[model samples]
Structures are given as structure tokens and as C-alpha cells.
Target: MTPSARRRVPAVHDALADLRWLINPRRRLLPRQPLTSSDHAPNRCARSSFVSETRTPGQASDYEYVCIITFIKEASTTLRRQQQLADMDEEVHGIVIVGGGICGLATALALHRKGIPSLVLEKSENLRAAGGSIGVHVNGWRALDQLGITGELRETADNVTEFHDVWQHENNKSVVVPVRGELRWVKRKDLIETMAKNIPSGAIRFGCHIADIKPANPGSHGAILTTLDGSIIRAKALIGCDGGNSVVAKYLGLSPPKSFPRLIVRGFTRYPHGHPFGPHFLRLRCNGLFVGRSPMTENLVNFFVGVWHPGGSVTKDPIAVRGLVLEKVKEQCSDEIVEMVHDVDTESLIVLTKIWYRPPWQVMFSSFRRGTATIAGDAMHVMGSYIGQGGSAAMEDAIVLARSLSRAAGSGGGGGELCEKKIGAAMAEYVRERRLRVVRLSLESFAMGMIWATKSMLAKLACQAIVAVLGTHSLGHTNYDCGRL
Candidate 1:
């Protein structure tokens, strides 16, 4: 047996033994009668009666199998009723998710798992993920496990085992901080396509822009979503998984506090044959500027090079922007790195220029509960990409929300006893519990970006020294407790 299986055998045997004692009539200290289909039909034989009649000489030796099968059928019937009630009580027939990104797709998948149907609305006619590769850590993978979507993500991702390689550009001196656990990296597009493929064909409604949203009924608590085409979709709830430029945020009148001090330039390119780094480790150059490299696929490496350009100076010229980014990368990198950036087909490179924001963590939990709406991921808390938590956190939110909603709906609590009040209370509870952890992560991401962007020689030296000493210690710990709900 494998080591893990061997270790678990004792616990498994103990559990079976305890179960046997509980079920055995002579050994049971508590009541020990076989459950019947109905008390009124006492004359009717129980399902177990058939088990005894159909059993062969050898089959009668295993009472556990009979009991387990009977119990499962009964339990399945009960669960079916719960699911029916959840569907009957659903306040919204259609759901409109604003963003077409990873978080938006994940939320849709979570809702679909509960058999709660939704419509994912994207403004773009064709699906396109924001450029750059993303890392899905252990906690993120756990959340995906709950959604039954991890396998899909795994198929398209490059499995990784380390945080990053820290190097000084001038000296080329580097040290590796081993990550405590494994992680997966994928092009943002791969994740999006995986999620989109799993959803029902008609589930995601693309080319639909949301212009305004307001309460459909002032006191009744339904919402009306005004689309760019001037059509209106009235839903029980609206989820603003929309990105930083989210119109939903604007419509809701929740002005997010600005947090991005620099314009971020990100994209992917093929590394040359003699590239300095390998696929297993992520490499970061920490000079006056910060550039990162990681495997997007077997042949391509995703690199993000950033500098502190004021928001207003970030115009729409992709060529000019690309040149400026290449120039900054050249300032701190060697010839090979420069050649990789230069070799990138300018037409294929994706460039995004925007000021980042870190919304109050409390916003994510609070926004959706108030008016048939809630926000998740970047829409709720926009932070720099330094910590690689944006997509993971969003997926986590979807998992928790799905499980909570499923339980509430399946228990016959959805429409009758469940009521809007109970639903609101549950949503509020989710927000309260999740805010602290996501907030801490947002703050950590912001701090990392600041430290990486420090330009003063003294400050940079001090920051590097601190990281060299404490960075490994802070590498791979994240709070992932979606199972609590």
C-alpha cells in the first residue's frame, strides 16, 4: 500500500468497527430497529425485506452492504426534495455578471453547481482575458476542488513549485526561496476558456454592456439592469465581478478609493534558445524597476515589466508604450532579456495602462447583500498583481457563496422558512467572515508592490536585505477556509 493509504487504514478500521457496533441490534445501547418507508404502512414490507429474500448464501455474510445501499437511496430522496425547494424559491431567474474574466466565470460555475441558473453578461463581443499569467496556489486549488473545476484548470496550467528567484540586476546574484507547497500557472486566457467551456452554451451572454442598475421595486428589493443596447434585465441579484473600470460600481455610486500609483505594463513573449532561466522557477529582477518571468506554456514565458508612470501619462499608443516598457527593462536587464522583449511580435503583445485600486475589503461582503447584488474579486478589492491573489481570491468567493446558497436552498429553507431575511443574513455572515482575510491579502499585495517599486538606492538596499532575510518565511501561507460555510 502507499504510505498515505497505510496511515489511513487504522482510522478506517476503527470507524467501521464503531459503525458495526451502532447498527448491530444486540450490541446497540440505543434503539435498534430497521427504518421503514412509512409508519402508516406497517403491513408493507420494508425495502430491507427484499434484501434478505434476494441474498445468495454468500451475500448474507455482508450486512454492511445492504445497510449502506438502503441508507443511500433514502438519503438521496431527502436531498432531492431540498434541491427542489431551493429552485422553487429562487428570487432571480437570470443573473448578470459584468466581467468576462476569471472571477466572473468562476462565480457562474459555482452558481451552476447548485443548479441555480444564471446569465453571465460580458461587454466584449469576443472573450479576451486580461494579459499576463496567473498563479493558483493551494488554497485556490482547494476552492476549485469544491466547484469540480480544478481538473479543467489543471489541464491548461504549468505546475510550479517555487515563489520566485530574487536577483540583483547589477551583480546577477540570486537566491531561491522554496515554496512550501505546489502552485499552478496558466495564461489568463486558458483559465477563462476552461470556465467558459464548462458553462452551458447559452449561459454567458456576450456583447451586453450594463449601463445603469437600479432597484426594480423600491421596497420589494429586486434590481433592474440597463444594458448598453438599452434592454433591461431584471434579476433577483446582480454580481459586479466587473473589473476596475466597473460600470456597476459607478452605477451603485460606490467610488472606490484610488490605490495604484504607477501604470503597469504586462504581456507574454517567447524566450530565446539560450534564455537564462528554466521553466521550474519564477525569476524577478529587482533593480530600480521590477520585471518578472515565469512559464506560460512549454515554449512561452510570461513577463511583466513595471515602472512608475503617472496615470495621465499612460496614453493609448501600444507601440510607444511597448518601447517605453522595453527601455525600462533594458535599464536593469542584460542582452538576452532585451532580445526577448524586442523579439516579441508587437502586434501580439497585450498592453493595459490603468491606475490600480485597493477597495476597502469590507466592500466585497457588503456590496451584494444590500440590493440583490454583491461584488467579488477585482471589482470588490482591486490591488496590484504583485501577490498573484486576484484570481484565486475571486474563485474562493465563488466556492463559498455556492456552498452556502446550495445548503440554504436544499434544506427547504429557500422559499418558505428560508425567506429573504434568512438569505440576507447568510450573505451578511459570508461578508463578515471573509472580509478580514481578503483585506489582509490586499494590504500585503499593496505593500509588496511598494517595496518592489522603491527607487532610492538606500531604500532599495534595505528592502532587499529585509526580503532576503524574511521573504522565504512569508512565501506560501494563505487562509483558505471555504469549508467553514
Candidate 2:
């Protein structure tokens, strides 16, 4: 068969199944109910009037016949081509990872590197390349190195050499600390696209929204995931790389991530000619407001502002988000910083979020794995970016998780059916290895957040003690590596 014909065969086969759903009476009526809502009532009435005026009852029957005939002809063609395509793909996969963000793709790539294939299910139709840049520290870089994309990423991002903190409440005190290890801010798009490019084609399936997940049966060896479209997927192992709102994590009986009463606005500013700021990562803290500026490249800078808002709510309007950031930073930041905020590209105002994290205690005790299913990244230990390890930590989770699973699958030999008992043990080990590391990060980040957000001096002192005991210094957490994948 010609290559073009082979490609058309699968497309037609998939289309036939999709058409079956489209032809269902129940499915056809499902969307019409929304049109009857109060907000759409007038439009619905107008549409009804037009239809009634355009067709008599006899003409309506003829119109329906035309539609039905066309649908039948297309479905017949789909079935004939489907047979010629000889598609016999299995409904079951060895490993299925939910969410195709940074963590999900990294986990898939890590498994690919170890010769264990994984299927990534992303709800979005395409890569979610939206959002601001992420800071990758030394530990994160190590994970990337194992995944074999460090060299490519370095070309797009420059390392952050120093941290410059300016305390406005402390009489404008300035402290400069040199970074001991690697730190670079790469655009979310760059990291995601680069990682995606290395992954095998057809490994990541888009537009697959998971509605429910359950064990195949009591004492079952694998998991059954139900997509919103009513299709079922069976997997020998399931990994959840979905973010803070992960449904897979919920299935593991983990508590939802707790929120901080703060609104963070992250935006990028561009200098077409050149930027004046050098390589230093700058931060300004005053009262309950915090601002950070990091250069991603020679002409582009990424900055964020955090305000201790009582309610963690921000308008979705881009203009309003930029204005709010400016309002919070103007009290303490320099005029140069203010100009940068004002000049921020309106389109780049993508991250206006209420910070959320799992408390350290929760991290220490939570059950991140159940049976053959487990979770990683934010789904396992979502933490605030106070320590700037959220992205990196997720990457670490990917490497460790893939490493653990590979060992288990390899023990039963490189190929053939996966052993569920071994897979569960590997998941437990991954959780055990990552628990303490992420707990420490959660503790330090929580303390730093308390110290910055608290108004009472007594409370601030208490948080300070927590920070002291944890020995949480800048660039300290970046030392440990997740080891080779």
C-alpha cells in the first residue's frame, strides 16, 4: 500500500468511531440543552423561528433524509478503509501517564531512554506551551542531563550567576549572594517543545480527557482509566504527572493542595535593542509584597510580583493584571523596575495565579502510590515557588520514577508482559526516595513564605527559627541530584 493510503486508513477508521458517537441521539441532544439556558434563551428562540420559517413539515423529512444518507455513506467508506488499514492496536498499554506538561513529558522521555514505552494523555488538543518561564536549578539540570536535553536547553537560556535581594522594609538594605550552582530561567514553551521533540512520535496522545479511574478489579494487576469520551484504557501501571488539580492524585486518596492567600503575577518584558540589567537575579521585598526579576536571555527578562492579598483572586483581564502588579510594586521598587512592569508585553501576562502547596507534614505522610498506580511532580508534592524548585523538583520526580519502574520491568527481562507486583514495589521505592527531599523543600518554602507574609514580628521570629533549623540557605537545595535515569 502507498504511504499516503496507509495514513488515510487509520484516519478514516478513527473517524468512523467518532462518527458513531456523533450519530447517537443522546449525544446529539446533549449540547442542545445548554442552548435552553436562560442566558441563551433569546438566541435559541430566534434560531427556532428561523428553522420553522425556512421549512415546512414535509420539507423537514426530506432534509433529514439527505443528512442521514450522507452520514451512512461516509460511515460505510470508513469501515471499508478501516479493514484495509489492518489496524489491530491494543487497548492496553504498559504504562500510561496522565497530563502532558513538563513532568508528564519528562517521565515519558525518561522511560523511552530506558527502552520502556509510555503513553502520555493530554486533554488539550496540542502542547500547552502557554505560561511564563520556569527556573531550573542545579538539581533540575541533573535530571535534564539524564533525559539528554541539557545541552540543547542551555543554548536557549543563560545561567543566573548571582541573587541580589533588596529589603525595602529594612531601610532599603541590599544583600548580594553568588549562586553556587547552575540556575537558569527557560521559557515554558522552550522546555516543553524541546522535551517533546525527543519523544517518539505517537507516544503522546492529545485530546484525551480522563473522567474517572478505577482498579480493574480487587487485587487486579493493572488500572482502568475512563476518558470523558467513554473509551476505556487499561494499563499495567499508571503515573499521574497532572498538575495541582490532578484527578489521578485524588484517586490515590491524597488531599487537595492547600492555597496561600497571595496572588502572584508573572510576566515577561522585552528589549528589542538590548536590556540594561546584567546577569544578576534581583528581588525586592517590602511589607507583604515581593518582586523578582530574572533575565532569561540578553534581551528578554522574566519578573514576578507576589502580594499578600486576603483573598487569592485576580481578574482575568491582562490590563488589570499588569495594573495590579504595578500597584503593588510601586511602593518599594525602583523606578526602573516600575517602568519594566509597565512596559511588560500585554500578551505575556499569562501567569496570574493564587499560590498553592501541600504542607510539609502532608508530604511526609501522604500515600502517593496505590496498587500499580502512582503519581509524580505537582500531583505528588505541589509546592510554592518560594525556593524556586517547583519545576526542577517535578523533573527530579520524573527521573527517579522512570528509573524505579525501569529496574522493576527489567528484572522480569527487558521485553514482554510487566509484572504488577514488581511495578508496585518500584513505585513504593520511588515514593520513599523522594519523600524526604520534597518534604525538606516544602518545609523551607513554607517557612520562607511565613516570614515574608506575616505581619506580626513574633510570628516572623517563629518562622525565622524554622528557617534557621532547616538550614535553608539560598542555592542550598540545588546540590542533591536524582542520579542517572
Top model number, lDDT: 2
lDDT of 1 by residue, 57-102 (tens): 2222234454456566877999999988755644354456778788
Residue pairs with backbone atoms closer than 3 Å in model 1 (clashes)? 368-373, 368-374, 413-418
Question: What's each prediction's TM-score?
Answer: 0.71, 0.80
Q: Name the runs in model 1 displaced over 4 angstroms.
A: 1-94, 167-173, 251-253, 271-276, 310-312, 359-368, 412-419, 452-473, 477-481
TM-score of 2: 0.80
lDDT of 1: 0.65
